[model samples]
Target: MIRIGAVSYLNTKPLICGLRERLSGIGKLSLNLPSRLAQDLAAGRLDVALIPSVEYFRATGYSIVSNAVIGCRGPVWSVRLLSRVPIQQIKRLALDEGSRTSAAMVRVLLSEMHGLSPETIPLAIDQTPETVDADAILVIGDRAMHPEHGVYEEIWDLGDRWCRWTELPFVFAMWVARPGVDTTGLAEILQASRDEGLRSLETIASREAATHGLTNEDLHRYFVENLHFHLGPGERAGLQAFQEKATALGLVDTPKSTL
Candidate 1:
């Protein structure tokens, strides 16, 4: 049976709705941090994983196995950068250890937009933002949903920043498989799972809102307004642009091909 790994973040709910039931006999699904999922996929512990987009570029023999992705056209409320200093003046930054793609995105934005390359330290998953003593801190997933109490120069929703700056969508993660894995019919299964999640957004929001310290309406709006699941032409273009930028920054290698 196929062993699949997915992110444990609320943002990933839409991509995995009813996925376990659908894969009951075909595969087993495990929830983990995006970083962990990537590591697991690389170590051969997982046959398939919803990995960070940057990991896809860095991996030597991985292939995108599904069209469904976690992306944003405009504002994505879950990935944030909180700064005590101005954007151009940030000299020290703390990156969320649970992230891979977002960490790369933040670096790319800092380099391209502000022309600043700051010293970055990892904010361990068990540590809170308040505990990090950097000029700025990047946080992703559920913790980012609730903004830090003290703020200063900027609070950037990375998705909003990328979309506004590039005029294109930002894809965070997608289903990928290691080399030699037989992915027969996997794309269709993933697509159907995404469809089921989209259709059940309201129910999902209702069930998950309070757990994430958000109102049901707020969560629902986030799913419908902030996020996009399909990897259409626009998304593919954006993904390509991102890869190009990341490659130029030496964050990842040039991807061999598309999904």
Candidate 2:
């Protein structure tokens, strides 16, 4: 059985909508935190995963399924940097362990975009704000959507920041398979699931609201307006830019074609 790993977040629901119902006879599918998905894929515990983009760079021999991605052009509210002071004055920053892509982006932004070398600290998934001595805390996923309800002095949307800096779309995640895994059939099934989710967004929103504490409207907006699931030319250029910056910063080894 093909062991496929998927992210357990509200943003991922649309991509995997009706997956459980349709994929019952296909293979063994597991829902995991995004960080764990990368580790599992590297360890051979998973054959394929919807993994963070930076993790794809860290590991080798992965072929990305065509035309599928978890991405956005601007104002991705879920991946944000909450700051106690102005961004220019940030001396230290806390990064989320669940996201390698965002962490690398932060580094690239600080160095290439902003011209600052802020000290970066890696924090656990459940770490509290008090644990950070940094001026800003970077959080990703559902937790970042609300951020202790008004505790932050300013919230910087990473996607928006990237667009402002590079004037291009950003891809946060993708469906990747280990080398020689043969994801042709699996990719078609996943595409069908994504299409189903897109068609019945109301149902997906209701389910997200019930489980993730987001309102249906918020969930719907996030899925429909805020996030882009398909990888297009602009997104590919953005990915290439990110890879270039990451390589220069020594965050990634090299850039493989995502075409």
Candidate 3:
């Protein structure tokens, strides 16, 4: 049976909607934090995963299923950079450990877009907002939704920043499988899953929000309107551009395979 690892985030619910009912007979699926999924995929503990794009560079053999993604063309409110000072004067930045792609994007932006070399520290899971002396802290997923009250003077949306810098969309994550996995079957399954999710978005959003104590309207807006699930040509171009800048900054090793 195939072992699939998925992110346990609101942004990912649509991608996995109805998957439990549809794929139950086919394989075992596990939900995990994004960072844990990356670690498990690296250790060969999972056969497939919806992982952050940057983790693809760390894996030696992996392939992405085409036409599926966790991405956005404009503002993605979930992944943001919260700062206590202006970005230009910030000296240290705390990066969320859950997202390698967003962290890398932040580094690329700091060096290429802002022309600054700020010290970036990885935030620990239990670390409080006051633990770091950094001027800004980068947060992803739920943490980003609610930072410490009054700690941040400005919240820079990463997707908005990318749009301003490149005038292109941003892709945060993609469905990836280990090398030699049945690519055709995996692709078919993922595409079907995405379609199923889109079809029942309302139901998924309502149930998820009720369970989490979030406003259903807010969750619906985030899933259907704010996030774009497909990785089309524009997003692909943006991904390529991001990789180029990351490679130039020596943040990622040269990617041996195409996205």
RMSD of each: 1.1, 1.6, 1.7
TM-score of each: 0.97, 0.94, 0.93
Error of 3 at 26 (Å): 2.4
Question: How many residue pairs clash (N, CA or C atoms closer than 3 angstroms) in each of the candidate models, in the order given?
Answer: 0, 0, 0
Q: Which stretches of candidate 3 lie over 4 Å from their true place?
A: 211-213
lDDT of 2 by residue, 1-259 (tens): 7788899888888888877777787677789888899999988899889998888777777878756689998989989888888778888889888888998988888787668778889878888765777888888998888777666777888989998889999999899898878676787888888888789888888876857788899889888888998888898888888888898888988667654
CA lDDT, every prediction?
A: 0.92, 0.84, 0.82
In terms of TM-score, how similar is model 1 to the real structure?
0.97
**Top candidate, metric TM-score:** 1
**Residue 169 lDDT in candidate 1:** 93
C-alpha lDDT of residue 11 in model 2: 85
Candidate 1 wrongly placed segments (more than 4 Å): 257-259
Candidate 1 vs 3: which has more TM-score: 1
Give the lDDT ranking, best first: 1, 2, 3
On residues 138-236, what C-alpha lDDT tens digit does candidate 3 reach at each position? 888876776677877878888889888889988888888887776557677777889889988888878888666578888888887679999888988
